[model samples]
Target: MSRRGQRLTHLELLERLVSFDTESSKPNLALMDVVCDYLEGWDVPFVRVPNAAGDKAAVFATIGPMVDGGIVLSGHTDVVPVAGQAWTTDPFALRIADGRAYGRGAVDMKGFCALALAAVPDALAADLRRPIHILLSYDEETTCLGVADTIARFGADLPRPGAVIVGEPTGMEVADAHKSIVTYHTTVHGHEAHSAKPMLGANAVMAAADLVSELNRIADAMIARGDASGRFDPPATTVHVGTIAGGTARNILPKVCTFHWEFRGLPDLDMGEIPALFAAKVAAVTRERLNRYGEFGRIETVEEVAVPGLAPEPGSEAERLALRLAGRNHTISVPYATEAGRFQEAGIPTVVCGPGSIDQAHQPDEYITLAALDSGAGFMRRLIGECGAP
Candidate 1:
């Protein structure tokens, strides 16, 4: 096909992908169906690694010779919710105007998916000595664990690739480092009493307030510690409280109160440090505040999601390959976390490089510029050339 025809195909595939509301909360099986069918048309060998519940799956497709020392292109199939965002165009329907394509996942991801799938023909024609693998995973916006089962199969029933490139919108600039994110939900249990009674029951709301204040103190300490490497924005690990709710009436001592919070840590920071500090505070708060009224209440914390950080691996195969394909000499650090760390943890060298600007991701009327899409196509072409070499 001609160059123009290939670009058109790429846009069409993106349109199809965006049409599916593969929100992190919903199942991505429908989107996987379309992807599997496309790979089938190309005669690409692929595998479906489904979640334990079997409601969703990750599709791993291979082109050229199925062997070790290949390249893996990874992207998540899930997009964030759009319920409250004010979008000029339909968030799930692809709309092209002013040299850009607008959609929810167009820039955050799906764009790279289109570019990779569009190169299926070229990858086949390249007669590559090293295989090119495309991995579409689920739940990256939430847990980042959707790739775990597939990564586990590498070298067992599947060929383990030498490097992995997570296609998260980095404006085609290679990224080698990012922060880790862990989310938590804390609940305070207390006994109910009338507002007139001071010592009869513990105040859950007051206890929750103390915890939130402690979290702020922790956030301040994290800021003071700062990023030692000077690569992270905000220049420090960030602690945030997203939501808090509790209480029945203003006059009553609430029986339960819950708050949601998270901390994004620098790659070099010890992951256990923050949690340990919080645990100590929880103990103190439980003793001094919640149970001061003779075991009238307790505090409980549950970890919801923990996504590891991607550290800089300077001379790694993934970094070198991505930098070369992207026509750059150095790598960058993305402030956001991604599934790239999962690959690195599996012992595969990994980097993040893809089309479009992350500045457009997750916002209302999100878009990927046409020029960026074309640039991504160029990157894939060069990769095909590299893998095709004898």
Candidate 2:
């Protein structure tokens, strides 16, 4: 166990963690091991939930005994890729300038995770009444897949948390709700023929273009629907296609085209209905063209992840606790998605409240101010006082 008088510094922990490349595509087992070791040093018991490949895993640790209800501190371990970003300094190395820590995951979380880890010593020293659970997940940047296993494990052998605080960057404001994210990859397969003989082959690129047009139409319709909450910026569900790829050369007709698209829905919106509507529209058009070609040229859509939007549960215990701890009288909604939605889906009431601003997240020279970290550390101290040591 760590000496009662000794506590890990947030800057020290952040520097060590940032040294590891836990990018979305790479395995985070190394970083997980380091975290597990730190927890073990603090005499905290934890469980590792491994992915199907067994290369990456989520770490769930509890400072108190197995109880009916505990408070979970959740953050994703993965950072977005810095491949194309223009950075003045090394993206992976922690650079401190003007009391700000700049790194890849500095703002879009890992700073919050480091704060949680650093607070373990203080939490352990307290006389707690309820357990404080730490949940660090992987693959949050790509798809919210790492938390799925942890969510499934709850209520079987795992303790169900009474409330979950997802440490997504919110500048310490209380975020009661956020938009749900649904990503889809659509593949269009057509026939290849000489470019001059265009009629001899169905155009996959054209089919994809048609689908993109329909997505835009959906976005326009959603805008007309407007938002009931009036908190969100756009106030309605929005659809966008991020990437599209098709064709090899100008002379030859392309046989396949693929496009990646996403939808961000308001809390009250029906997330599943959007994709279903698009799929139906694509099916109708594809079938008509396939009949002419006498072959089944295809269009298929696969969901990468579906993070449900959190509906504000009025007077809920989670909301009350979060509001009280954050010293806030009101809660707000965001336009981005976080792991809080997944936790809520698992029957754990959740809120998003953490340090730093979303504006700095995923941008070049990403940073978190020292003031933000200090404020977050204070919140953790108060949480320990309220919950007590296990």
The models' CA-based lDDT, in order, is: 0.93, 0.86
Please give the distance, in angstroms, between residue 13's alpha carbon in candidate 1 and its true position after superposition.
1.2
Kindly give the number of clashing pairs for every candidate: 0, 4
Q: Provide the lowest-lDDT 10-residue window in model 1.
A: 1-10
Model 2 per-residue lDDT tens digits across residues 111-151: 99999999888777785679899999998877777799999
Could you estimate the TM-score for every candidate?
A: 0.96, 0.93
lDDT by residue for model 1 (1-390), tens: 123223347898999999999999999999998888788777789999999999999999999888888899999999999999999989999999999999999998999999999998899888998999999999999899999999999998989999999999999999999999999999999889997995889999899999899999999999998888999898999999999999999999999999999999999889999899999988998999888878799999999999999999999999999999999998899999999999998899999999999999999999999999999999999999999957
Q: Among these predicted structures, which one has the highest lDDT?
A: 1
- Candidate 1 local accuracy as lDDT? 0.93
- Worst lDDT run of 10 residues, candidate 2, spans 1-10
| Alpha carbon RMSD to native, model 1 | 2.5
User: What is the alpha-carbon lDDT for the whole of candidate 2?
Assistant: 0.86
